[model samples]
Target: MSGLFSSKRLRWFAAAIVILNGVFPALWILFTSLKTENELTQKPITYWPHEPTIGNFISAFQDQPLLTFLTNSLIVAGLSTLLSLFISALAAYAIARLRLRFRGLILTAIIGVSMFPLVTLMVPLFEIMRSLGLLNSYWALVLPYTVLNLPICTLMMVSFFQDIPRDIENAAMLDGCTRISALWRIVLPLAAPGVATAAILAFVNSWDEFLLALSMNSAVAYRTLPVGIQLYQGEFAFPWPIISAALVVAIVPIVVLIVIFQEKVVSGLTSGGLKG
Candidate 1:
């Protein structure tokens, strides 16, 4: 009985540590956002705000075109995620169901493509976008973001699609549904968790990407939230509170997305692991 009790206590302790590790940094940033600039610079550093104010948030908006940045990010990230999912879904389904030769090699190549350092591709991508007249446009970010997200998204979907029994899709096809139609109406519905998981991941990656957004969409009109946040820092000054506020605001969409799809994300992650 004592051994069992000790084991349970250890497990609880580990879980608490894991939760705190993840949650504490965000909480610290939230706390920092509410503090006054003077309070932030004071000695011994306060854990919470001495005087909470929304001034930092207001300044964040006024000092830069924050809303415009957010809009650009939304458009870029949304388009990227949609394109990634669409292309990945078709590719994954084919790989999962079709008896295509060298499918394993194909998946390996996909993974290999993703493994290339983003930095190495930047120069080539820049030239390509410039030549195509895509620079400073949504496509500049959207197309690259989609390519970056495709490999992992496709791999994840393949696992989920493979796990689903073929009989279900076979039945649909016999009832006059084409393979594409059956995928749309049948297999996809059953793989909702995987779809949700891939979407959130692709969205988060595109949302937080800074280098591509900074380089490809240098125009003020097309800058994303990550690039726009850098505008807050001057040569001699860093408004930590205002910057923290922007950080908090930047994360709201991602937080909300995860919350809404938490169940599917959890199920998808766990079930994907269970696949052979």
Candidate 2:
């Protein structure tokens, strides 16, 4: 009885600590976002704003083409996620089910590509984008983001597919289903969780991608949210409140996505980690 009580107490304490850790940073950002520039810069730093206002958010958007930046970000991230998921799902199905020559070798190579530092490819990628007339266009960001995310997404889906029984595929085949039909009808439904996980990851990566977006997009209209937010800072100084507000705005969609699809995300991650 005592041991059980102690364990419960420890669990409660751990939960409280985890909640605190997660909530504090968001609270800090929120608190800072509400502060005026004067309050933010005041000596000895105010923990809470004396008079909270949405002026920072207004100013942040007013100072730049934030709506256009957000629209571009949404298009790039959304398209990148969809493309990555589509390509990776098909490739993962092939690698997981088919017995091609050097299948293992190919899978290893795909995984190995993900391990290479992205920075190493930046210059080459930039040159390629430039030569192809893709620079400053949506393709410049979307294509590279999709390709960069594909390896890991495919690997993740492959592992998830492997967890499913081969008998299921065989059954579908016996029912006169083609390989593609079986994949679309049978494997995809079972692998929905994994696909959702891959989509979330791809979306987040494409949305947050800074280096490539920065290098490839020069037009203010084409810039994504991250790059747009950089404009909040003048050459001489930064706008803390406006920057904080912009950051808060940027995080909202990601938070909503995670909240809405959190169950699938958790299930996919956990199931992918376990071998059947």
Candidate 3:
């Protein structure tokens, strides 16, 4: 009883520390966005603003098309995530259930594609995009993000699928359900956590991706939030207040996602823990 109590206390303390560490940086940026420029540039930076203002927030949109960036981000990330999740679910289902030769090798190969350095592929990806007229379009970012994120999403769904007993699938088949139907009806329903996990991760990666987004879209109209943040910089100095305000705006979608899908992520990660 004493040992269990101590273990629970330690876990709670560790969780608190982790939560604080994650939230602290965001809080600092939020605070800085409210501070006057002079206070931010002070010898000893102020922890709390003496007079908080919404000017930075106002300037973020006024100075540039921040809303356009946000919209582009949403379109690219949303489409890429949806496509990646759908394809990953199909691929993961096959890998988990199909009696294909070299199954392990195929999985490893997919993961290997992910491990290929992003930089090395950039030049080829750029040329391909230009050849296909994908440059300066959302498809440029969306396609690359979906491809890059597939392996991780596949692995995630695979783990969740593996946790489900084979008997459930067989039972569904015995009930006259086709293999595809069994997957769609039985397996997928049981793997909601994995689906949510893959979707969230794919969305976040596409939303935050910088290199592809930067190189793919030369037009301001197609620029994403991460690259759009750079538009505030100049030869003279960085606009710290405006950048901080942009970051605060940028944080909202991510925060909302985590809040909505936090449980699914946690469950997907721990999906197979009880199984073997």
Collision count for each candidate, in order: 0, 0, 0
Q: Cα deviation of 64 in candidate 3 (Å)?
A: 0.7
Report the error of model 1 at residue 45, Å. 1.2
Model 2 lDDT at residue 172: 93
- Model 2 is weakest, by summed lDDT over 10 consecutive residues, at 267-276
TM-score of 2: 0.91
| lDDT (Cα, 0-100) at 21 in candidate 2 | 100
lDDT of 1: 0.95
lDDT of 1 by residue, 1-276 (tens): 999999999999999999999899999989999999999999998998879999999999999999999999999999999999999999999999999999989999998998999999999999999999999999999999999999999999999999899999999999999999999999889999999999999999999999999999878999999999999999999999999999999999999999999999999998887874
Error of 3 at 245 (Å): 0.5
Expressed as tens digits, the lDDT of each residue in 1-276 for candidate 3 is 999999999999999999999989999999988987888999776888889999999999999999999999999999999999889989999999889899989988998998998898999999989999999999998898888999999988888888789999999999999998988899988999888888888999999989989899999999999999899988898889889999999999999998988998788767645542
- lDDT of each structure? 0.95, 0.92, 0.91
Show the colliding residue pairs in model 3.
Answer: none
TM-score of each: 0.96, 0.91, 0.91
Better of 1 and 2 by TM-score: 1
Top candidate when judged by TM-score against the true structure: 1
User: Could you tell me the lDDT of residue 57 within candidate 1?
Assistant: 95
Task: Give the CA lDDT, 0 to 100, for residue 102 in model 3.
Answer: 95
Candidate achieving higher lDDT, 2 or 3: 2
Clashing pairs in 1: none
